[model samples]
Target: MYLNLTPKQMVRLNLALAVLFSGVGVYGLQSDSLPISPYTCFTLAIACVVQAYYSTEKFVAKAALSNTITATDTSLTVKQVYYQCEKEEIVELSRISQLKVADNYLAVILDGNGQGYDFQIKGKAEAIIERLNEVLPKALLKNSPIKQV
Candidate 1:
């Protein structure tokens, strides 16, 4: 079974916030009456730029993941994008430990380890959960924790 997921709207919101913060920082630096010191304004501007860069990077990464998950009876392959580059991770089904469904995200645990990768669900979390239920191993899903939104 193949599953494709897209980035949620929060990505865009973060981008917008980044821009707003940057503008405020720049304006603060230019306005003498603003009461904020030049150093403070500069620091704020740098922070905002850093946030914007990360937000844009996150958006790109999520966009690149569109329809990149491919799962077979034996293994699952996930293609992830980072800074315009593509990376693939392949895992054997036998290595999967469990799946966790939270309010608006899903996590795939591997090798009976507590660590895992998380994906944010775009819409209707229940639908995604149901589809996953059909495609994933019954044992993995049986004792999984699903949080209510």
Candidate 2:
């Protein structure tokens, strides 16, 4: 099962890039014919290659869940692999007092002993939250039953 990014996203990205760098590529191509310093053309070509590499990586991640979660008896392991441009964080499911799926991210409420970090699953936030609810053991998810203290 693979989750794909919407076609509209791809189309919009392509259109934006076309508008952004088409002139640069065309200028480089035209200048290469003029027989001046070849460095400008080389630089432009390199820039295009780098841009393609970056976009390809982003598209791959946007197309699927780059991270994985494995539920265990005592705790849940959330191995979140973020894109190179993105940041990654480690989270222990035992510390999570609550889990909420918001519009675009997962809000993992942590316990006081930990730093109380909220783990955000980037693309498939809802799916990840559902999977966690399904696969996580009852003990890890059990709270104190709301005792009045």
Candidate 3:
């Protein structure tokens, strides 16, 4: 269930977080006592909490689920749960699709509606693509207009 991120991706994420948190902290310090006519202190407090979440690596996603895949009918259903690095909440996705792999991520295009969402799989993007392609039905691509690779 634990999907580990590649060291490169993790480093990039960490660097981004560092810059964002630093900016937030500096802004807070410089404008801490500034009075607001419309916004309340509660809003600023909430922003601080969000900034804190990004400052720590504890929020990075670690696991995802592969719930279902049906080969006979060329239909697949997969549910992937991920941690939203800053929000500290698990994002749950129930997707039924033909999988597509890209340079840095994988996209699951839904068959029924012709809609899809993308996931940035940490380290095993290529391997996951190969595995999904092997397991999913070939007929799933017959009617799909989107190109797969």
The candidate 1 region of ten consecutive residues with least summed lDDT is: 2-11
TM-score of 1: 0.47
lDDT of each: 0.59, 0.52, 0.47
RMSD of each: 7.7, 8.5, 9.4
Report the C-alpha lDDT of model 3 over 39-148, residue by residue, as the tens digit: 44345544555544533444333332232221334334433334353112121223454556654455666545757766654435555556565655555444432344
Q: What residue pairs clash in candidate 3, if any at all?
A: none
Q: Which candidate should be chosen as best, given lDDT against the real structure? A: 1
Give the TM-score of each candidate: 0.47, 0.47, 0.34
Whole-model lDDT, model 2 = 0.52
Quote the positional error of residue 137 for candidate 1 in Å.
Answer: 5.6
Candidate 2: regions farther than 4 A off: 1-16, 24-63, 85-92, 112-115, 142-149
Could you tell me how far off, in angstroms, the CA of residue 33 lies in candidate 3 after the best superposition?
26
Superposition error at 112 for model 1 (Å): 4.0
- Candidate 3 lands at a TM-score of 0.34
